[model samples]
Target: MPKLMNVRVTTMDAELEFAIQQTTTGKQLFDQVVKTIGLREVWFFGLQYVDSKGDLTWIKLYKKNEPNNCAGQIMQKLFQPNELEIYPTKVMSQDVKKENPLQFKFRAKFYPEDVAEELIQDITLRLFYLQVKNAILSDEIYCPPETSVLLASYAVQARHGDYDKTTHAPGFLSNDRLLPQRVLDQHKMSKDEWESSITTWWNEHKGMPREDAMMEYLKIAQDLEMYGVNYFEIKNKKGTELWLGVDALGVNIYEKDDKLTPKIGFPWSEIRNISFNDKKFIIKPIDKKAPDFVFFAARIKINKRILALCMGNHELYMRRRKPDTIDVQQMKAQAREEKIAKQQQREKLQLEIAARERAERKYQEFEERLKAMTEDLAKREQDLQNAEDKIRALEEQVKLQQQAREELEARQNELQEMMIRLEESKNLEAAERQKLEDEIRAKQEEVKRIQTEIEIKNEHTRRLEMEVEEARQKKEEANRQLLAVSTTPQHHHVEENDHDENDDLPNGDVTKDLEIDSSIVDPVEERRTLAEKNERLQDQLKALKQDLAQSLDETKETAMDKIHRENVRVGRDKYKTLREIRKGNTKRRVDQFENM
Candidate 1:
């Protein structure tokens, strides 16, 4: 097959984050995950092949594109319409039958277990954290402009980019712990530091606070959890006015457990006394592995502004706490509302898309219709040309036929004239008389010879056929007797099913007519006529018989007796039911060893 140049090879990755925390590996990982999730049945169907040239010739998988051998076999398996696009790719994939160093990364698709719904919140949170970590390690994440809201922390004052309310500073925003103080000075104030300053102002005026600033700030922090933010703090609803800060991955939420006494969860659970004078907390986990707690610290913003303060637990007094972290039902409802809104937007867009598609389709159809009309016009024109040619050829044939007919008529007339003259003459030359007599004698001799040979062969062939047939009948009868003897033991169980109705009985008069007509079977015309005649005679006989036996016609026959006539009908139709084939078990079970 000739190769075509139009082929595309692109790689795509599965966009889903891990369903469970797993070390990514081979098929077992997916299998284990799916098993853990509990899916009932899974069937995967796809052609997996790599293209040596990185060109997918999946089109060859289709019947039209298939080479003589394995073509179309795989296509029939998948049978997806979009599979047409992949067929060319499949063919190209054959080029990679041998291992190639080139490897293609592909996306994974999830065919979730039955009844599983999307856990958007769960999945998104994990992915966001992974992205942040990857970006930190790779540094290819984002280099946002200084005007970016995230850059407004007081720790890194305006040295460039786009933070509006800051100076190109030589001093660093004191709280940035990651970068050197000098490098920190090169960037602008982060939003968290500025927000902390605002919170401090709000605290100073707590007696005359403009609004419920503290409560609102708490609410914002709570909402941030839903936005993939892990770090969170609670101001005493009554204590800390509003101190906003970031921790280096450790957070101490001041609260009370069931005892209503201060019970704080922190990295340093055993520390007798601890305090944060510098407001910088570095969480060094003591467990075997990193603790599963949401390594809560990432980035921070206070009062819609940046700050450079990191927080840690400063041992302090606390109060009993009763809290609702998440409301599942309300969250579901909110998600549903958002989904509906999105659906409406999508549907409206889809309507526009569909309308445009319909218009395009109609235009395409019109174009095709026009092309068809043009083709039809061309066909009709060609047909007309052919008709004209045929007419000319037929005229020539007619003229030739007419000429031949005229010559034949002329010859016939001449023959008639000669015959008339010959009949009237009555006298013949002696030589001519002798020649006629000799010709008649020769013809008569030839006819006798043919008749004699034909008679002899006919009798001999018939006699030989008769003897052969008789011998064949005897042999067949003997074979049947032997078979019946062999089968006798098996039949003993159903001794009743043993008659020859197959040979003796048929539907109404159909059997008798068939038998009577068999004699003439070698001649189709005679056989049909004989069968019809027998049928008429049988019908008359049946009517007479029925009239005589009308009183006894109601007698019922038992099914067992019918079976006793074992030469019964085996219908082709019964083969449609599998159970009918099962009936052959008895015959198959019975075996006889025959030896000469």
Candidate 2:
């Protein structure tokens, strides 16, 4: 059925079996385990397996697992005989005794071992530093005196990139800054002494960068051999507390009371397989000649999951680190002498470098002082230039003000002359106006007299016309009476006789009537003469009135011109005075600016 392989799955608390295809990935198995166990935070979990070299290796989900491909084979493949485990990102170490609880406590010594070994120490050290700092800050762990020294040294290195013997310690590396005041006082190293000591120490690390040195030294202090390790505490039958460290180097068990020394070591080289039940752990060695070793921490009541973890770590170390031969040698006398000579040379060189640094510092101070003086001189020059500019501007302003004053004064003089001329013209116009008024009055009187004479002539002519008409009517009546008398008979004959008689005597009466008729002469001719005179007087009056109007307009124009001239003169005088005042204020401002 689909070429299924029998694979054993192990966890912190239990072990189980699953039938799966060889091609199944770690992710698929991890998911199944999480789903079955109802594990929380599946993302922070992974499956790790031990290889033939006794090194623990993480199974990447993306890559194919070769060992799992074998089915029904007598080989100790990953799934056939061995097991894989689901572990938290930071594996837990359980202390088994008195049924004690499983705690996720990791030791400071195992701090660096958690990071990937392939990563450079520069990067790995940073991780360790942060983890250690957090652990200490949270009071989860404490750093001893020797550990603090290593921390301080590494901290200095991290702050300033790798160490250089030629360069002295930076000012920030002072004991007060790197260490607490109390710590510094306890050490009793003066500033100079502290600096010298750090410098000498920094010079010794010539092989690797500071970060590598820091991590390497930290591992040594913690007494750790490999990365990615888990430590457990267990007790034997006698109730003697013992520690077991499981890493890529198989299982290391402490024999003596001291935790650093290992009494028994299983490198996974002779280990064939592992299995456990509750507090019982068994290791099957590959060498047929050796018997299987069994361990029990019944009093401590070790958890079965911890045994699984131990088996997993043993398999990892067995697979990763292959057994190889190593050659050992001892240092000869010649090598020792050469190393001492190198040390002496390095010390002598440091002395010379210190002397040069002091000289350079003095020169730098002198140069700074020179630069400051030069800057001051430049500032003074700038001030002088500004003052000169102000002076020039004031001078230009004064010249402008003087020129304006001259123009104003000239305008005033011109306006004064114009005023004098306007006054003279005004007087002349007044006299001319008076003369025209007098002439106009005389013409008016003449016109009035002529008008009255024409009116009287018209009346007299009208009366003469009536008298003529009455005389004509009397003549017509007398003719008609004479004709009737002459035609009608005796009376008319009698009158004719009397008329002859009177013709000789009628001389006086007839002459008197003729004279009266001649006396009634037409006055139209006299009236015509008066009318001509009246028209001539009217023309003269019109001409005189026009002249008077012209004279009045001229006087008005002259008066307006005179007023305009006076105003202009006063305005020019005022403008000149204001300009003079403004110039005085400008001069005062210029003086103030100069003083400043």
lDDT of 2 by residue, 1-596 (tens): 56565555565445656765645655666667667665432333455554334444444444213354333222222225424453332111211111112111111222322233422323334445544444433323323222334444555665564566446435546633443333233343466655554544444443334454555445433432222345566655445566665654456555334333344555545466665544545566565555555555552224444544554555444433454223101222333475477667756676566568777776786577557656655655565555555555555655655565565556556555655555565657777757655654555565555555555655554555555455445545544644443353443221223344444544444211112365654343344343574466346445533433332323323332343235345653222422332332323422322232
The Cα RMSD of model 1 versus the native structure comes to 41.4
Q: Give the TM-score of candidate 2.
A: 0.32
CA lDDT, every model vs. true structure = 0.32, 0.45
What tens digits encode model 1's per-residue C-alpha lDDT throughout 372-399?
6566556555655555555555556556
TM-score of each: 0.21, 0.32
In candidate 1 the C-alpha lDDT for residue 236 amounts to 34
What's each prediction's clash count?
Answer: 44, 24
Model 1 stretches with alpha carbons more than 4 Å out: 1-275, 278-307, 310-359, 378-397, 423-596
